[model samples]
Target: MSKVIEIQDSQFNDEVVKANETVLAYFWAPWCGPCRLVSPSVSWVAENYSDRLKVVKLEVDASPDSVATCKVEGVPALRIFKDGNMISSHEGAIGKQGLQDFVESAV
Candidate 1:
């Protein structure tokens, strides 16, 4: 099973922003092709780095509040959060290695 947690706008604050540990928030939409392409890498990160990172996914269409709050203008957006603040973000379909590097850089 995938380790990534599916979150909605209502849960964003409590689940991510208020979390004590580092967070990886993935923003995507059901119709976004690039989102599908990048999903495996996200899942890989969730499984491999579960000890250090809290991985969560928010559907763009379903979670408009979160999308706007994070300034996510595109699908497959990955935002790294620490201490209730966004530390880094990338908008696109980054491959497995690239995703790994991205997460590593933050955590």
Candidate 2:
């Protein structure tokens, strides 16, 4: 199976901040149209890069506690982490290609 992770406030530090592998995260609110539209692309990349990366989807509304701690100011934001450090990110729906490119380069 693919290695995309679903993280919550209880597991944020250990699962995300302290992760040994590259973590690719999407911060999206439930009502975001573009987030829904580009979700398939995120899933595709997650599956495609399963061997090299860890993908995650964080529901901003559901995880308000994490949102505040992580300073996630916008919906549909992408954050890339490797070696327990945030390396890159972008706002809005970056589509599959854009996301794939960013994550691929992040590692």
Predictions in order: lDDT: 0.95, 0.79
Candidate 2's residue-wise lDDT over 48-98, tens digit each? 887888788888877888788667887788888888777897887776778
Best by TM-score: 1
Lowest-sum lDDT 10-residue window in model 2: 1-10
RMSD of each: 0.6, 1.6
Off by over 4 Å in 1: none
> What's the true lDDT of residue 13 in model 2?
79
Clashing pairs in 1: none
lDDT per residue (tens digit) for residues 30-80 in model 1:
899999999988999999999999999999999999999999998889999
Off by over 4 Å in 2: 1-3
Q: Which pairs in model 2 have colliding backbones?
A: none
